[model samples]
Target: MLPQDLITEILLRLPVKSLLRFKCVSKQWLSLISDTHFRHHHRHASSGVILCRRTDIIHHVSLAGSNSDYQPFTSLCFIDDSAGVKILQSSHGLLLCCSNYKLGKARSYYICNPSTKKYSILPEPDYVSVSDNSSVYLVFNPTKSLHYRVACVRMCSSSFNSYQVEIYSSETRDWRSSGSPFAAPFDMVFDSGVLWNAAIHRISPTGASLCFDINQERLGAMPGLPSNEKWSRRRLRYFGESGGRLHLIEIYGCSTQFQVFEMDMDYSSWVPRYNVDIAPVVDTFPEMLRNCIVRNDFVLYAFSLLCLQEDEDDSLLLLHIPGQFVSYSLRNRTFKVLNSISTESNNAFQIGCFHAYQFMETLADADQYL
Candidate 1:
């Protein structure tokens, strides 16, 4: 038998694909991978960079790790049409994804570890019906036994103008309805298995926008926008976590000036953090970016625009919004652009339903590593 440290050392070096397959190697290994300590270690070793796709093929990009040269790490392909998935959110080493197509009444949400290839199809949501229009969020809670939870909010725009919330637990394979009712005003986004809890940008007597918390499976008020600032409901684009804080990125319409703010833990306040300028990118590409941001603890992967360059026909340049993916040190108010990223690929890759983890070399860094 391998020594515990030896086994861990070997396991840390293995890619996520191999690790997932090896979960059945032995109960000890299974327990190790499931353990919080090991998970933290795995999350750190995988940080600072990410694997992305430009066209149909998947390739690796350096986001914050040792490979600053922008080297291609791997090439991946789907087995068939059904194999293509769109990543909605990533947490730990696992990814939350759903099939790209809108198949009538077909449940598509799945939790998978792309590195290990271990996937669990979430039990068919109880509240999703052919007639009811509802939105869903998927959450992974470490404090709650590492089980996956799904929350769905449905709006009844009829006479009552009411909404309902329900949660599904993977461990129990059951769905339970929450006691409270909410009013659906705007759409919601989930991070690491909790609703992002957005501020109510618009207010109407009959309807109001609200934020939903995935972990608690409850509804709460969204924190207000920055005070004494000219703001519009549309300019306020809610981004997931960045730099260990719940973040929001607001742009001034194709203009270079933009703002980044962090949401307080109480879900009641907003603190202005940084102002960004994307004017430099306009010279390279004529059009603005249509990108989504996702995070794993301290690092945020800003999925920006995909452009076809004049010289490179088959290749595309991924324009990442700066400051979206950086390391934040609150004590010093200093942030660092991750060094373990690939600069060779002028364009970043699109994250279609993919997952990435931090590459950790030690223990202290692993705390909240995901």
Candidate 2:
């Protein structure tokens, strides 16, 4: 048998691609790599996105081993259909993809580990859209637990003009519904089992930004906004994570400047944090606006057109810039350009919306190997 020290040394150096494949070598290696402690070590050793751009293809990028020099990594493509993929949320190695076509009627949800090329399909959701509630909102946190539970909130008709929420536990693989005294069509964001439900009241052309919590399967309102009407009037956007904290990014519909607010540990209030801005002209890029994702320290905004000069193919040039990823530092109050991603081919299909989840890896024991 190889010495444990040697095993650790070798595994630590394996690229994420090799490591993903080795996960199935045995349950033991999977547990070691998936462990939170191990992930932190790897994260520091391997900074930057391990994944990017969802076209007819999906790509994974990793930092060169302990090297500061920029090393263009290998790209892996999953080209099944021209259908593009959107990453909703990610944890560990598994990615949840919501693949919908034709007005999202024949939508398909999948849990895939691109590294291993292994995927599982989730059964179609069956929630009756009865009464005034027109749509169902689903949020997932794969990092919450080993089994990766998917939580959902449904808008159902009620006599008192209130909305109802339903919870689903992937561990139990079941959905249970409950009623909330609150009203309908609220915006939602989730971290682990904690659900943030924000009321959407139209302010002129904008919406109100009041939020509530639904943890332990119970609902309650969050604290009030601190900024003046100017702040509240701005579009209240729910950004998944900012500087390692759950945050809400508030931006004026007509302005380039935006504010960031962190979720209070008490889950009772939103503490105003940082400010950011992009060139208003940047909004023209549809990709930048539509399917952006936030990482531990970066905010990725999509751009629509890529432009090239002279022999400039307008289409290629329009997509040339691909997308811009901005990494912000809360401590320094500064931003840095992270990287750019592009579609391998414009022939790639387009998606309206995507559902994402990152599997919260758990320690594996001899008895619990899958």
| Highest lDDT against the true fold, candidate | 1
Candidate 1: 10-residue stretch with minimal lDDT:
307-316
Worst 10 residues of 2 by lDDT: 307-316
Cα RMSD of all models vs. native, in order, equals 10.0, 10.3
lDDT of each: 0.46, 0.42
Per-residue C-alpha lDDT of model 2 across residues 1-370, encoded as one tens digit per residue: 8886777678766656566778898888888777765644442233333333443343332211123243223222351333444544444445555553545345455555454455555554476432212223334332344455443444434454455555444556656665454552333322222223322111112233333343545445445554555533444443444223455555544454566676686657678765555453355445555566554444544432111111121100112223443333433434344334444422332322222222222122111111
TM-score of each: 0.61, 0.57
How well does model 2 score by local distance difference test?
0.42
Q: Which stretches of candidate 2 lie over 4 Å from their true place?
A: 9-13, 20-54, 57-86, 91-93, 103-105, 125-144, 157-163, 178-182, 185-215, 230-238, 251-259, 275-326, 333-335, 339-370
Q: How many clashes show up per model?
A: 36, 19
Model 1, 162-190: lDDT tens digits are 77667776766777776577554443322
